[model samples]
Target: MGRGDKKSKKGKITKGSYGNARNRKAIKAKLKRTASKKTAAPADGATKQKRTIKKKAEA
Candidate 1:
């Protein structure tokens, strides 16, 4: 149950492998960041307004 145990955090680091103990929060945070980037609103408000205007004109 120490450094050599595969399920423990120390062992995962020693073995250079990712598991629940070693990378859970890091993985979750990374996923959240990417998801937020994908779904985030545009930084420039003008671009969004332009897109809406074009859509309304096309409709």
Candidate 2:
């Protein structure tokens, strides 16, 4: 009946993975946080072009 118990009526039916629902939910939350935290630069390569041009002029 307990979440930590692996024994069942059919003799260790919960031996394989996905035995703990809480752990599975936590794993899903971690994946979602990492995926949504990604940031994208809206300016693309335009902002970096100015820096490279100045360097080329000095050389």
Candidate 3:
């Protein structure tokens, strides 16, 4: 039987009581690191333009 303090089959914490708190720490660290990264913006003269979605046709 799987224990509550270890990772479950799908790699999630089995209990909500800080049993196996490693998952929480790892996820938080990952989020912090990812949030620190700065994404590059499109160049002013690039071919990219604002996108628009097509309207749905009347049934």
- State the lDDT of candidate 2 residue by residue for 1-59, as single tens digits: 65346643222335445534436577789989887765544555544444444445665
User: What clash count goes with each model?
Assistant: 0, 0, 0
TM-score of 1: 0.40
- Tell me, what's the RMSD of every candidate? 11.4, 11.8, 6.6
Q: Pick the lDDT winner.
A: 1
User: Which model scores highest in TM-score?
Assistant: 1
Which candidate, 1 or 3, has the higher TM-score? 1
- lDDT order, best first, reads 1, 3, 2
> lDDT (CA) for every model shown?
0.82, 0.54, 0.57
Model 1, 1-59: lDDT tens per residue? 88899999889988888978988789789999999987877767545344444445665
Worst 10 residues of 2 by lDDT: 7-16
Check candidate 3 and list the clashing pairs: none
lDDT of 3 by residue, 1-59 (tens): 36533455333344443335445677788988787653544568465578999999999
Q: List the residue pairs that clash in candidate 2.
A: none
